[model samples]
Target: MKQFCQTCLAGLMSVFVMFGFSISEEVQAEETGQTAYVDVSVATLWSEPNETRPVDAPSIGNPVDMWEWTTGMSYEQKLWLVGNLQTQALYGQEVTILEEQGDWVKVAVHGQPTPKNDLGYPAWMPKSQLANDASFSTLKDIKEFAQVTDPTAWLFEDKHRSDKFKEISFNTRLPVVAETKDAILVATPSDGKKWMSPDAVSIYSSQEDIEKPDGQNLVDTGLKFLGLPYLWAGTSGFGFDCSGFTHTIFKAHGITIPRDSSVQATHGTPVERDDLQKGDLLFFAYNEGEGRVHHVGMYMGNGKMIHSPNTASTVEIIDVFESDYYSSEYAGARRYID
Candidate 1:
């Protein structure tokens, strides 16, 4: 009987190994280190634990045609063009530390997942980027939080329009102290309570705001980012990717959309290309009418669309049907608002 039982146990262990279910709760706990929140308003998530290579450095998988584009650009322009593939973690963003070495830490960032990492959008951020503040872990302690609606906002020293200090990017969350007629009082990322123009902010007192997605207001708010640089995976006016641009714009209006173009394509009711209206999201893929969406933009009426295009470009208005690239690649559209 003992010999028979030992053989059965070995068979069961083999089954477990074959299916790849070896990690137990204790093992998982041992692998996962500390949980931390992003300490600053924004932190860059790098592809590797090391510092990002200089913008002018040759990219590993870059297309052969891009060599000309890279050489024609100046060093400063190349620097601006770089870092589009990296994503950003916002203030109070939660992440789990997986491994640490020296000053860099590998973390699984929480939010709309990206295709970059199977382990919940894994990336490397500097150790100084994380915070263990009790405030982040306990949201009930916060009375209210101000959501930045503008592409970029400034906290003025006073409401009288003199002496401005800190500048915050879009989609940043800050705790609100008071609400006045013209301004909302909130703690600046670097300073104490300060007044910011009410027009540039949306105050959320309750969690029901998600039920009300203001598409018109979202489109109007997105217009403020015109002429801003295009940063890959950016969700702020400091820079923005196509989906990040749309996501932050809708977030300002209390509608939370996914963080990538492919996922955003699956959201909302599908709209016919001819029926495209302001605030409608347009998607594009390389295969003309079929295939995975790789880009997104907001329709601006009269055959025009607003988007961040790609690297070496800024947020700009384009004739959607007039541009061969967009016209040929146009996949479809969707309406998320009433």
Candidate 2:
């Protein structure tokens, strides 16, 4: 018996994903800032097909990624890589380069939110590289980089000297696939750079295949990080913020969604608030007079939503239009799943 959400498109089933985690590894993410970390099934350039790995990890030795990282990842970002393996660029432009805090440092070209010029158009700016070393393995490395000073400057050169992670070869230039000044040099032997698991799992409980799961998969995969500590700008099952969670959940289902709620809201068709449905997006604006959505959440039917509220609010369920905190600031709603 398929339970259709009365509030949804007449035939759409109300997906009730109960995110839960085990005692040893319940990873839950918190929404804090504009940036976050994400762990996902990446199609790497050298991962092997049969390389024993978790569902979310890139196959060892398989050349080129299978489009793993959540789609619509803002280019001006810093992602925590778990392995010492070099980055095999597939797309996007690289701007700044350096090593900081034992992680591969980078400055990316992506869409950044900015106030309107005379045209009321949103422009892309080179945002600062935030050092969010949550990748257990990445946090252990000393190859780090940060976008400092004028991060908006697209042409920022770097020459870093870290005491940690011994230089494997200074003369040996790390091959950068992209047309960026960013160069990679092997760092000193740190702890274990052996983390290859992307920490992926099927979102469906009854499904057997790890590669794909139908509608149930989204909810099941989301529940994988039931209790992981929330981190701002997160986008992986290992730990994820609000948009990260939504992005990861949809990706597993073969659905491509923009990385942030603000962006995701634009990908799908608009729906009236009174006619909202399950899995739809609900936006909010604290400064209502400004009339711009500053926050977003997943409309989980029954007047509830699943989102990592604010820095203070944990990733939990609450009434959508009824929540005293959300209703007053409610901006609008949209849906992607047709």
Q: Where does model 2 exceed 4 Å of error?
A: 1-104, 107-220
Which consecutive 10 residues in model 2 have the weakest lDDT in total? Answer: 147-156
Query: Which digits, one per residue and each the tens of the lDDT, describe model 1 over residues 42-115?
Result: 56666555444454233221111122333545646645534434566666566788877556777877654656
lDDT tens digits, residue span 1-338, model 2:
22223235222221222333222112211112232121112212111112223432322322212323323122221133222212221112122222111222222212211132221111111122122334432422322221111101111122232233211100111112122233222211112131110111112221122244343344444445555434345443323456756765664454656656666656678888789777777788757614666677777667877776543445677776776768888878777666
lDDT of 1 at 296: 97
lDDT of each: 0.69, 0.37
Find the candidate with the highest lDDT and give its number.
Answer: 1
Consecutive 10-residue window with the lowest summed lDDT within model 1:
56-65
What are the models' TM-scores? Answer: 0.73, 0.41
